[model samples]
Structure formats: C-alpha cells, structure tokens
Target chain A: MAKRITLPITDEDIKNLKAGDSVLLSGTILTGRDAAHKRLYELIQNGDSLPVDIKGEIIYYVGPAPAKPGYAVGPAGPTSSYRMDKYAPTLLELGLKGMIGKGARNKEVVESIVKNKCVYFAAIGGAAALIAKSIKSEEMLCYEDLGTEAIRRYTVEDFPCIVAIDSDGNNVYETEPIKYRK
Target chain B: MEIRQIKAETVTETVKKLFMDCNYFIGKDIMTALKKSFENETSPVGKSVLSQIIENDKIAANEEIPLCQDTGMAILFVEYGDKVVIEDGSFEDAVNEGVRQAYCDGYLRKSVVSDPVFDRINTKDNTPAIIHTKIVSGNSIKITAGGKGFGSENMSAIKMITPSYGIEGVKQFILDTVRTAGPNPCPPIVVGVGIGGTFERAAQLAKQATFRSIDSSNTDPRYASLERELLEEINKMGFGPAGLGGNTTALGVNIETSPTHIAGMPVAVNICCHAARHASATI
Candidate 1:
C-alpha cells in the first residue's frame, strides 16, 4: 500500500521519505510555475514583502486550463520543475517544506532539499484529468496578471505522488533509470 | 482549367472542429500502443502508471475535458490544392479564424505568447497559428491541425551533420537526446525524426512526422527499419511511464526524410508527448 502524508509536513515526515515511495498528500498547497517563480524570486531578491507565505507549505508547479461551470479548476497536472531550479533554493531557504511536480532537478536544488529537510514529490506528468479530481478547492492568491501562471492556493485530498527526492537527497530520477535500464 | 471554389467559412468550421475533437479524443493508434505497452510493461509501477494514463484519457473523452493541462500552441499544416480557390478571403486568415474559435469555444488553454523575447504576453485566444502550407495537385484543401504542448516540445533538438557522420552518427544522436530527456517530455513519448532537407525543412518534417499514425511506418524499408530500431532502443532505456522506471519509454518513432544538399545532412528531433493531439480534414 502507498504511504499517506498530510500537508504542512514536519521535518520528521520529510526525513522518513526516501526516493520512490508513493505518497498520498492531503491538505493545502500553493500553486506556481515559471512565471510565478520568476516573480517570487525577483521579490525575494529585491527584499520586498512576498505576496503569500511559504513557511512549511508545498508549492505545486502547474498551469491549469480555465475551469468549466461546475469544476473548482480545470485539469491541473504538474509541469516540469527544472525550469524553477534557479529559484528553488531561495524558496527552500525561506521555509518552503515540499514541492510537487514532475521530472528531474539540478544538483543545487537537490542539495537544498537535503539542507532544508524538504521533499520533492512527482505527480504523473500526463495524467491531468485524474490528478484534477484531487483538487477540492482553489483560490487565487496573487500574480493574477500572469493568467494560468498566477499563484493560487489549492486544497487537495489524497493527492497521489511519488517521492522523487527525499531529505537525504536521494533522487529517484537519478537512481531509477540505472536500475530499470535493460 | 476547372477551379474548385471553397468558401473560407467552410475551412474555418472544419479546422475549428478538428482542433476541438483532437483535444478530446486520443487517436486510435496511440490508444492501441498504450494498451500494448501496458501489457508488456514489466514493472508494477510502470503498469499502474500506464493504467492511470489510459483512464485519464477515457475521462477526458467522456467528460469533454482536455487530456492534459498544457493545451499547447496551435500548429496547422495546410496542403492547398492548386485547383482550389478560396472565394471570400485569404487562406491564412481562414486558418487563424479557425484556431481562435477552437481555442475559445472549446475552452482550451491559450498558451501562445505574442513574442519570443521582449513582452512575452499571452495572445489570449491562441491566434496566429504556426501554419505551414504546401501547394499540391488536387482540388481539396487538406488541413492537419493539432495542439503541441511545450513540455515535450522543449526537449526537441536539431543538428546539422556532415555526410561523413553517416547513419551510425544519426542513431547515436537520437539515443543521446532521448536519454537526456529521460522523464521530462512526459514519457512514453512519440518521437519524430526529420532527416535530410535544409535546416528549416528538417525541423518542419520532424514536426510533421509527429502527426502520422503511431502504427504506420515509413514507406522506405531502410528508414522503417531505423524507426523500429530506434523505438526498441528507446524503450530499453527504461524511462517508463512518468519516468518512475520501466520498459515502456517510447510509444513510436516516426522518421521522415527528404533529399538534402550533398554538403549537409540536417536532422531534427521533435518529441511529442503521449497526448499527441492531431486531426486532419480534406475539404
């Protein structure tokens, strides 16, 4: 059975995770992508007040479609996280606890994950409709001008993901290919 | 000489429907490939991931939602018949109108930014599609339209190899690109390899190759063998589904080649995600 995890995860929770562990995450998480990360990184560099709090929160890298009449948001799937690598370490230092996205991260970002006692989880990259079912509620936080790249808060339930990088900095994206290659 | 007059509105309507339908429906060839991949996948994690992707596609089809969030940039390939004439307006305007209607009416995401460099603002309606036109010797206008998501698109590559590099070099380059891409382009992916032609022609052929049915092979026996070999090699690398690890790394590899200058062998790899949304209409 997959392990179950709750949001605003503690360091203990992060430390227990190792790369390749399937997890079901619940509770609140923030959403951002390339544009939002650039803006947030700029704000930090300028030493200006951030629009949203990052302390002990997870940020999902996604840009979803516009919601239909009844849905909270449209199909919300994880985008590639490597584009955010340049800004990730800064966010980690500011108390960001976890990140949910897909694909590999660079060396610096992985090191920051270990140093910050944080975890990186990967949702299925192409499984947008399936993933969107987990999002129970969503509200815009800031950077609405960025359109779908805008920052928002999402309340998810049992959001499925795999631990791509753990606090020990063991990265599944690195080790898995070696083990599975024919 | 007989001229077949086709109203611009008819072209617009056809294109709009094609884009909308392609986004909602997974092509039969892709669906078949996914099922086969699921059956052959050795890893339990890979198998389950494939199942989820299959289920996700079904949900998108039945519920009328998009298969992936990155609805992508509009790309249209127009094969204009020499004998056909648009009665009301210009050919480019008709194609753009179709794209605008499909993106807005179908509720697809508008991902086109106005400029590549300065002022990278969303075009809002996904207008000014990347349309490539070729004049052919028929009376019908054949349009192949699709949305190309950038997640995989960004992973694509191009190289201008000297004739001395040969086929072995071509194979190695493809292998390197897929290996480096790993899990990023949303495996299992459809790889489109464009060989020969000039630099821009190679890139266009690579893009065009992605729209072919995954089950089809190149007409030339030599290139078909190369396609099969590349597909086998890619799957062996074990990027699996979502790169979590497994044998089903790539679904298909389509190669399209044209005669090129004796001095240069331009090659381009255009990677399309499994969603590979595309539909064609001849009217």
Candidate 2:
C-alpha cells in the first residue's frame, strides 16, 4: 500500500520511510532541473542568497512542457536525477528535505541524503501526461530566462512516487533489481 | 524521366503535421508492446507503472497534447526522390519551417540549444532540425520522423572494434552499454544496434534503427535471431518497467547492419525510451 504524505517532509517522515515504499505526496514542492541547478550551485559558491527558501523543501527535477488551455502544467514528468547529482549535496546541506526524480544518484548525493536526513523519490520516467494531473498549480519563481528549465513552485496532490533512497541510504536502484534479476 | 515538382509549402505542411502527430500520438507498435509487456511483467510495481504509461498515452492522444515533456529535438530521416524537385525553396528550409510551426503552434517544447559546450541557448522554436537526407531513385519523398527525448538518448554509445573482435565483440558491447544504462534511459527501452559501419555511419544507423518500429526485426534471419537473443539477455537484467525491477527490461532489440571496411567493424547502440514517438509519410 502506498503511504500518503504531505510536502515539506520532516526528518521523522524521512526516518520512517524505507527504500521501495510507494508514496503519494501532497502539498507543495519546488521544481528545478539542470539549468536551474547550475544557477543555484553558482549562487551557493559565491555565497549569494537563494531566491527561494531551501529549508524543508522537496525539489522536483523536471522541465515541464507548456500547458494548453485549462491546465496547470503540461506533461510534467521527472527528469533523470543523476544530472543534478553535482548540485544535490549542496542543496541537501541547506536542509532540503526530499527530491523527486527518476534514475540513480551518485555516491556523493546518496551520502548527503544520509547525512542530511533527506529522501529521494523516483517518479515514473516517461509518464509525464499522467503525472501532470497531480500538479494543481504552478508559479514561476526564478530563472524565467531559462524557459522550461526555470525554477517554479508547484502545488501537488497525490503525486505518485517511490522512495528510491531513504534517509539511511537504502537505495532501490541497487537492491530491487537484484531480487528480480535472472 | 519526368521530374515531380513538389511545392516547398507541401513539404512544410507534411513535416509540420508529422511532428505534431508524432508528439501527440504514441505509435501503435509501441502501445501494443507496452500492453504485452504489462501482461508479462512479474513485478507488481512494474505492472502498475506500465498501466500508468498506457493510460498516459491514451490521454495524450485524446487530449491532443504531447505524450512526454521532452518532446525531443526534431529528427527526420528523409529518402528524397532523385527525380523530384522543390518548386519554391530548398528542402532543408521547408523542413525547418515545418518543425518551427509544429513546435510553436502545437505547443511542443523547444529543447534545442544554440551550442553544446558554451552559451547553450534554447533555439525557442525547435528549428534547424537534425535531418538526414538520401537521394533515392523514385519520384516521391518518404520521411520517417521522431521526437527523440534525451533521457534515453544520453545513454547511447558507439565503439570501433576490429573484424577480429567478431560477432562476440558486437554482442558484448551491446550488452555492456545496456547494463551501464540500466534504469537511466527509462526501462522497457528500445535498443537499436547498428553494426558493421564506419564510426559515424554506425551511429547514424543506430539512430535510424531506433526509428524503426518495435514490431519489426532486421531483414536477415541471422541478425533477426541476434536481435531476439539480445532482447532476452537485456530482460534478464531485470531493470523492468521504470527500472525498479521485473521480467521485461527491453520491449525490443533492433539490429540494422551495413557492410564495412575489411579491418574495421563499428557498432552503435541507440537506446530510446518507451514513448518512442515516430511517424512516417510519403509525398
């Protein structure tokens, strides 16, 4: 059974979750992808303040298509998480609570997930149209010049995901495949 | 021989329709493969994921929206008839204009950047599509086009192996690439292996192989068998649907081969995600 949880996930929420637990996330989350992450990393390096608060936020790595009429966002699915591996540790250090994306993370990002008591969720890759239904509203927050790769805030309800890596660093990408491997 | 004068605007309109239709509608071959994989998939999670993908495709088609967000950089494989000539403009410009209109008017995302290494700026309208054109001996132009999302494309690889490396070398390289790709390219991926070509030709053939329908296999019996064997081996990896775990890692393995130099044998593997958006038209 999938656990129903709200966003701005707490450390206790992270602790109780294990790798492979199906989750339905509600409430609000931040969106950023490769270009947005690069800008955020630059700001952190130069000791500049971030445009959006990172504390207790779950960032979704996605660059959604432009919505048609009567839509919040268009066909928004998670991008590959590994692309943001270089920047994820820094965000985790700033008290980011969780991340939603597809694919595996690097060693450093996985370690940071453990250290910072963060969780990594994997939304089904390529399931963009179905996933978009969960996003109820979206507002551009920063990096609008980056276009779809801009940073935005999304209000989501019952967004489906799996805990790919939990706070203790149990990673589904490593363990689950082993079980089913012939 | 009579020249078939094709209006440049005709080409533009055809290309425009192809892009929009390919983005909005998941190919029938892919939809069927997904259904078959869903029934065969052992993992409960994999089954659920496949179900969602199936539903997503149907929704995108009915709602007339893109099946995936990446909508991909535009790619067209054109077989231009030698006896056909465009009336008003160059074939290239007409095709780019088509891509521009489809992406902008159809609401597809424009993912192309002005440069790769530095100053990567979005092309905005998704113009300057990557087009591969061949002059053939016919009066009509045949175009096979697809919107190639990069999640799986980034996992593609190519290598130059000697003739001494033989068939075993080819198999090993294909398997290694898929293993390395694992879940990253999105599971139930379509693996396109191009063998026995020069470096760049191999890569192009690999990309072309991806545009081939998953319902089909290579023409040669030996290559077709190899395709089946590779698909089996890949499924054994258990990356499954969404790569969480299961029985079906790849929906299909397509091998397209060409005769090569005596000493050099190059192989390229182009992995494509399940969306596999491709459409064809003859004009």
Candidate 3:
C-alpha cells in the first residue's frame, strides 16, 4: 500500500519519506510554473512580501487546462521541474517543504532538498486527466495575468505521486535508470 | 491553365474540426502502441504508469475533454497545390480562424503568447499558428494539423555540423539528444530527426517527421533500419514510461532527409510526447 500523506506538511513529514515510495497526498497545495516562479523570485529579490505564504507549503509545477462546467480544474498534471531549479534553493530557504512535479531536478536543487529536509515528488507526466480527478477544489492565488501559468491553490484528495527525491537526497531519476540498464 | 477554386470556408471548417478531434482523441496508432507497451513493460511501476496513460486517453475521449492541459501552440503543415486558389479569405487567415474557433469552442487551453520577448501576452485564442506551406504541383490542398505541447517541444534541439561527421555523427547526436532529454520530454516519445539540409530546412523536416504515425516506418530501407536501431538503443536507456524505469523509452524515431550543400550537415531533433496529437485533411 502507498503511504497516505496530508498537506500543510511539515519537515518531519517529508524527512521520513524516501525515494521510490508511492504516496497519496491530500491537502491544500499551490500551483506555479516558469512564469509564476520568475515573478515570485523577482519579488523575493526585491525584498518585497510575497502574495502567497511559502512556509510548509507544497508547490506543484503545473499549468492546467481551462476547466469545463462543473469541474474543479482540467487535466492538471506536473510540468518539468528542471525549469524551476534556479528559484528552488531560495524557496527552500524560505521554508518551502515539498514540491510536486515531473522529471529530474538539477544537482543544486537535490542538495537543497537534503539540506532543508524537504521532499520532491513526481506525478506522472502526460497523465493529466487521471491526476486532475484528485483536485477537489481550486482557487486562484496570484499572477492572474499569467493565464494558466497563474498561481492557484488546489485542495487535492489522494493525489498520486512518487517520492522522486527524499529528504536524504536519494533520487529515483538518477538511481532507477541505472538499475534497469542492460 | 486550370485554377482550382477552393472556398475559404472549407479550409476553416476542416482545420477547426481537426484541431478539436486531435486534442481529444489519441491517435489510433499511438493508442495501439501504448497498449502494446503496457503488456510488454517489465517494471511494475512502468506498467501501471502506461496503463494510467491509456486510461487517461480513454477518459478524455469519452468525456470530450482535452487529453492534456497544454492544448499546444497550433502548428500546421500545408501542402498547397499551385493551381488552387482561395475564393474568399487568404489561406493564412482561414488557418488562424480555424485554430481560433477550435481552442475557444473546444475548451482547450490557450497557450500561445503574442510576443516571445516583450510583453509575453496571451493571444487568448491560440492564434497565429506556426505554418509551413509547401507549394506542390497538384490541385488538392493537404493540411496536417498538430497540437504541439511545449514540455516536449522544449526538449527539441538543433545542431549544425560538418559533412565529414557523416552517418555515425548523426546516430551519435540522436542518441545524445534523447539521453539528455531523459524524462523531461515525457518518456516513450516520438523522435523526429531531420538531416542533410540547411539549418531551417532541417528543422522543418524534423517538424514534418513528427506528423508521421508511430506505427509506420521510414520509406527508405536504410533510414528505416536506422529508426529501428535508434528505438532499440533508446529503450535500453531504461527511461521507460514516465521515466520511472522500464524498457520503452521511445515509441518511434522517424527520420526525414533533404539534399544539402557540400560543406553543411545540419540536423534537428524534435521530440514529441506520447500525446503526439495530430490529424490531417486534404481538400
């Protein structure tokens, strides 16, 4: 059975998680991608207060499709995490505890994951429809001008993911491929 | 000289329907390949992930929703007959009209930005498609419309190398590109390789290559074998489905080649995700 985790997660919750563990996350998480991350990084550099609180929150790297009538969000899947590598260490320093996205992260981000006692999770890429079903509700948070890239908050139920990089910095992307090679 | 007068409405209507259909429906060839992989994939995680992707496709079709959120920037490859003439609107206008309506009515995401550098504003209707038109010697016009999401598009690369690098160089580059892309392009990708042309032409050929079905092989036997070899090598990399780990990293590697100058050997790798959403219409 997969581990079941609820959001507003703590360093303790994430530190106990290990790479390759299947997880079903339930709780409030924020969504952002390249554009939104850039804006947030700029705000931090300018020493201005962020529009959304970062402490103990998980950020999903996604820009979902527009929802149809009676839907919370449409096809919300994880975008590639490497694009956000530049801003991640800063967010880690600011108390960000978890990240949900697809693909591998850079070396620095993995280091930050270990140092800050956070976790990096991978939701299946291109499995957007399946993932979106877990989002129970969604509300726009900031950067409305960014369209789908806008920051939104989602309350997800049993959102499926794998711990790609755990607090100790074991990375599935790096180690898993080596085991499978002929 | 005979001029084939084609109504602008024909182009607009065909394009609109193609865009919506391609986004919601996974191509039959890709669907079959996914099913085949699901059975063949060895890793338990990889198998389940493949099953989920297939299920997602089914849900998108039954629900009439987009298969993925990135509804993509509209890209059309037009094979226009030299003798054909649009009766009312310009060809470009009709194509854009079709894209505009499909995105708006289909509830697909509007992903195109008006400007790449400054102001980066959303066009709101996925307008101004990236169109590549080739004037041919026939009366009928053929349009291949593809919804290209950027997750995979961002992983594509182009390089200009010396002709002396030859076939071995091309093979090495293709493997290297796929290796670097890893899971970022979404594994089990369709690789479109363009070789032996000018920089722009090679890039165009790579784009055209992605429109080919995953089930089909290159017409030329030499290139066909190369495709098979590359596919085997890529699968061995163990990127698998979703790159968690397995033996099915790439579904197909399609190569399109054109004659080039003596000194130049330009190659482009256009990696497409499993959704490889595209459809065609000829009128």
Candidate closest to the true structure, highest TM-score:
2
Strongest candidate by DockQ: 2
CA lDDT, every model vs. true structure: 0.92, 0.93, 0.92
| Native contacts kept, each candidate | 0.74, 0.73, 0.67
Task: Compose the digit string of candidate 2's lDDT tens values, residues A1-182.
Answer: 99999877877788999999999999999999999999999999999999999899999999998899888888899999999999999999998889999998999999999998899999999989899999999999999999999999999999999999998999999988888898
Provide DockQ values for all models, in the order shown: 0.82, 0.85, 0.79
Residue B69, candidate 3: how far off, in angstroms?
0.9
lDDT, candidate 3, B89-192, per-residue tens: 89999999999999998888999888899878898899989999999998999999999999999999999988788889998898999999998998889999
DockQ (model 2, Cα) = 0.85
TM-score on alpha carbons, each prediction: 0.98, 0.99, 0.98
lDDT of 1: 0.92
Total clashes, candidate 3? 0
Instruction: Put down candidate 1 lDDT per residue, B115-228, tens digits, no spaces.
Output: 888888988888989999999998999999999999999999999988999998899888888888989999999999999999999999999999999899999999999999
* Model 2 per-residue lDDT at A21: 94
> Per-prediction count of colliding residue pairs?
0, 0, 0
The candidate with the higher TM-score, 1 or 2, is 2
RMSD of every candidate to native, in Å, equals 1.0, 0.8, 1.2
